[model samples]
Target chain A: MSLTLETNLEDPDAIYEKLIAMLESHEPEKALRASARLVLLLINHIGDRKVIDEAIERAALLTEA
Target chain B: MNVETGKAAWRETIPVWRAFEPSPKPETEFEQARVVIVGTGPVGLAMAIDLGQRGHEVIVLGRFDFVPAGSKAICFSKRSLDILDRLGCGEQAVEKGVSWNIGKVFWKDRSDPVYKFDLLPVKNQKMPGFINIQQYHMEDILLDRLKQLPNVQIRWGHEVTALDTSEESAIMSVDCADGAYRIETEWLIACDGNKSSVRDLMGLDFEGRIFEDNFLIADVKMKEDRPSERWFWFDPPFNPGQSVLLHKQPDDVWRIDFQLGWNIDREACIKPENVNPLVRAMLGDDVEFEEEWYSVYTFQCRRMQHFWHGRVIFAGDSAHLVSPFGARGCNGGFADIDNLGWKLDLVLEGKAPFDILESYDSEAIVTADENILNSTRSTDFLTPKSDISRAFRDAVLDLAEDHPFARALVNSGRLSTAISYPDSSLSTADADVWSGGIAPGSPALDAPLDNGWLLEKLGGRFVLLTTTPFADLPSGLDVLDIAQEPANGLLRERYDLQGGGAYLIRPDQYVAARFRQPTGAAIADALARAMGEQA
Candidate 1:
C-alpha cells in the first residue's frame, strides 16, 4: 500500500487547530524540535519504510514550492 | 455543591498529638541489645515487629513522642499489603484504607479518560492492587502491632546523638528527655527517613538526580462520593500546562496533587487562599470541601552506593530516595525489610553465616535500582525537560485517544510492584525446562486454597511446597503437600504443577529453587546455598 496522500483525518480542521495550539505552547526552538519529534512519532506510527519515504518526498516537494 | 469558608472545621479533625515520654534509663552505663533499630517510621516499626516475632529482642529508638501527622505515603501497593499481612496488620490496613485497582488517565479538557488500566488484572488474590490510607494511620497500625510483641521495646524521645561501629557491634549514644545514655548492639539497622541522622553520623550521601519541579499536595475532606480510583490528568483545563493527580483516601479526605513549575513561593503557595482557588477550579465553585492538610514537595531519585555498612545497616528512605510517582518509596522500604528480616534472623541464630547479610545488601540494591529507574522515567514523562520531549509527550497524548500504541507510551506513574532478584547468588539456577511459572529469586505469587490464602502459610521459615510427598526430608525444612488439600487447583495452576513438581521457598517468601522432580540431596543443597553456605 502507498501513502494516503488525500485528507484522511477524521476532523482535519480540528487536527490542524490542535497542531497549532501545540506549537504555540512552546518557544520557536522548542517548536521546531517538537515538530521534528512529531514527524518521527508519526513516521513510527506509520511503520512502513516505503510509505514513510514517499510521504517525506511529497512533504519535501511541497516545501520546495 | 456547598463551599465552606475557613480551614478550622477540617483542621479540627486532624489527629491529636500525644506527648513523648522517655523510657527508663538502663541500669548499666552501656546496655547491650540483640537488635537496635533507629527511627520510628513504618519501616523501623515493621522491622522491629518482624524481628520481635522471630523471638529476637529488638530495641527501636524514636525521636518523636507521637505519630507524625501529614499524609506522606498514601498509596500502599499489593506487595506492601502482603508484607503487612505477614507482619499481622494487613486486615486493619485494608479495612480502614480505600482499596482500588483502576486508574484512569485524562487528556486536556476531556471529561472522559483517554486510557484506563486495571492494576490487578489477575484477580482472586488475597490482597487488592493498592490501598490509599494516611501515612499516620499506617504507622499507628504498625505501632499497635509492635506493642503486641513482648520482645520489642519502643523508646520514644530517644535520639541517636553519637555512633561508633566495630566489626562485631554498633554503639550508639542516645539522648533522651532525662539525659544521654549508650546502647551497644550486635546489629543496628537505620530506618530513618530522607534527612537521616544516622546517615549523617556515618557521613554517607546519596548519589542521583534531584528534579527541579515542585508539586503541591492538598488533602481535603469532602462529602462527595467519588469512585475509589487513581485519576491523573495531563494539561487539564483546570490546571493548564501542568499535570494533576487525584486519589481517594479513607474518610472523606481526597489527595489532590498539582504540578507547580520550578520557581514559586513555596510558603505562599501552600496558603489556603492560594491553594483554594486551584482546588475550586478542579472541583467547581459549588463543591463543598475543607482543606485538611497542604504541603509542597520536590522529589529526588538517589541512593547510597551501599546499604550494608559493616555493623551499621540502612533501609527505607535512609538508604534510598525516589520520586513518589511510583509509590516506590515506602513499598521499596518494605521490600528491604522483607529481604533482610529472615536473613538477619538466621544470622542471629547461628544458622547462617554472617556473609548472608551481604546478600541482603545486593538484593535490596536490586530493588532500589529498579524502583529508581521506574520513578525517574515516570518523573521525566510527567515533566518533560526539553521541547522535543514535551512535543513527543503531547503527541502521544494526542494520539492516545484513538491509537492503542500511543496509549502505551503514556506514563503517569508505573505504580509499585515486587521486584525479583534474578541475579542473586543465593538462588539455585533452574535445572529443569519450565514453560511458565514463578522462577528462582522471585516472590511467591498468592492464590486461594481450600480454607485460606497461599501467602498466609509460607512466611517466617523455610518451607517446601510440593505436589508429591517425600518419605524423608532435611531437618528444619517443612513440607506442604498440595495433594493432601481438597481445593488445590489454583495453587497447582499458579505454580505450574502437573505432578511431582516442588519449590523450595525462603524464609522471606521468595523462591529459592524449583524442580520438576526433586531429591533430598538437591533440596538440601539448594537450602544450604540459599542460607549462604559454602559448597
Candidate 2:
C-alpha cells in the first residue's frame, strides 16, 4: 500500500513494456484513448500532488527535448 | 405427462411428446460397433449424426425412455447453430425456436436499462445471434435427423452397467429390459451427462471450485406480449437485494430464475405456496398464470483434467460443467463434438495418426477452461463472495447508468460465443503481416453469397479458398473461388483477400492457416502440420 519512489527504475521499465504491448495490439484511435485512461488511472492511484507534479515535469523534460 | 387440450397456448403449439421405442436385441454374446455413444442427449445425438454421416457405424445408448422435462439450456449461440447446420438440424431449430439478439440490464430502483448490448450487429451471417428453444425440441429435431443416417442405431432403455477400455478397444456391459448384453467397440463416447457412469467407473473427478449459492428456476405459461429479448435485473423491486433473470421460450412460456441465498431450505423454496408469491411479484398482481414445472438447483464450474482417456473419450456434461448464467453448458458440448468428430473419423480410417485425436483432448480442455473462466467470473459478479466485492459491483452498476466507461464493467452474463483455439498445436503460427483478419486457429467469418451463406459451402470438407484463379489443387483438397460475382466484394473485405491471399480451412469450418501469397508447397506443409505431423 506504499509507493516505491526511491527505488531503481525497474518498475517503470516493466510498465513501459506492458504499455507498448497494449498499444501494439490495438488500432490507432483505441490506443490513443487507452493511453489517456492509463495516465488517469496511474494519477488516481498515486494521489500525491508533489509527486505527480515532479513526475509530470520529468516526463515533459525527457520527451520534449 | 399429458396436457389438457384447448386450455393453454403451450398445449396447442407444443409438439406431442413421444418416447423412444425399445428395440429387440439378438441373443448373442456380444455386438460390435465402430463407435458406441452412451446417452442420447443433444450432445450424444449430434455426435451420432456427425459420425454416422461420415460412414462410421454408430450405436447410441440412452438410459431414459423419453426426453427430459423442462426447457434446459435455452440459449443457443450462433456458433452452435452453425455446427448444427452442418449436422442438418440448424434450419429446423431456427424455424421452431424464438430468436433474440438484444439484451437489457436493469439495476435496483431504475426504470430504464442501465446497459444494453446487441449480440449480432450485422445481418450477413448464416444464423442469428442466438435462439431460445426448449432442449426437448432440439433433441427431437436431432433424433429425427438421426433417422436419415442409416449407419446410426439408437437403443432406448439401455444403461451401461460396466465398461472396460484399453489402448485398442472398449467393451461395455449394457442392461436392457430383457437381459444384459455386451457391446464391443473401437471407440466409446461418454456423453452421459453431469453424473457420467463412465467417468465414475474410471474414477475421474472434476477439479474446480463449487459455488455456495442456490437458484430456483420456474417455467410458467401465460399470455404476455413482451418481445423475445433477454431481460436481467440486479436487486429488483420484486426481489429486493437479489438478482433475477428472465428468458422467453416458444409457445408463450417464460423461464424465470430467482436467486436464493446459500442457507435457505431448498425443499421449502420449491413448494407452490412459497414460489407463487415470487411469481406474482415478478408479474403484476392482476396477471394470472399456471406453473408448468419448477426446480431448485446449484451450479459448479468444474472440468476434467483431460477430455480423452485412452480409447474411451468423454464429451458434453461428462467432460465439463459450468454455471447456467452464460449459457455455456450445452453450447460448449457442441463445440466438443465438432472438434472430436473429424479427428475420430480420421484416426479410425487411418487417414491420420492417433496423435491427432490427442489434439481433440487438448483443444477441448482449453475451450472448457475458457468457459469455466467466463462462467466463474459471471457468477462471482452476480453473487459476490465477499462484502467488498459486492460494494464494487454496486458502484459499477451505479456508474453504469450514466457513464459509458462503467458500462463495460457491468456483467449480467457474457453470452456464449465461438472460442478461437489460438494456442492449439494443430494451428500454424502466423508469420505474415496481417493485423486484423481472422488468423490461424480462428473460426471462419461468414459472408453472403448468391445462393447461400459462405460457411454452407466451405463446411464438411478440407477446402482451399482463394480469391484469385487457381489451377491445380493438392490431393483431397477442394478449391472455392471467392470471385463468384455476387459475394466477391464482401468476402474479399471480410477475409482480407487483397493481394490474392489463400486460406486453408478445416472440415469444421475453422481457419487452420492463411498465406499472404499463395503457394502449393506452403499449403501442403501447413495442412500436414494441422493433421498432427511433426514439423
Clashing pairs in 1: none
Worst 10 residues of 2 chain A by lDDT: A1-10
Model 2: per-residue Cα lDDT at residue B501: 86
Q: If chain B of candidate 1 is superposed on the true chain B, what is its TM-score? A: 0.96
List TM-score per model, in order.
0.89, 0.87
Pick the DockQ winner: 1
Off by over 4 Å in 2: A1-65, B1-17
Interface Cα RMSD of candidate 1 = 3.2
**Model 2: clashing residue pairs?**
none
- The stretch of ten residues in a row with the least summed lDDT in candidate 2 chain B is B1-10
What is candidate 1's lDDT per residue for B48-162, written digit by digit as tens? Answer: 9889999999989987666768758899999999999999999999999999999999988888898999989878899999999998889889988887899899987678989
In order, what lDDT does every prediction score? Answer: 0.89, 0.85
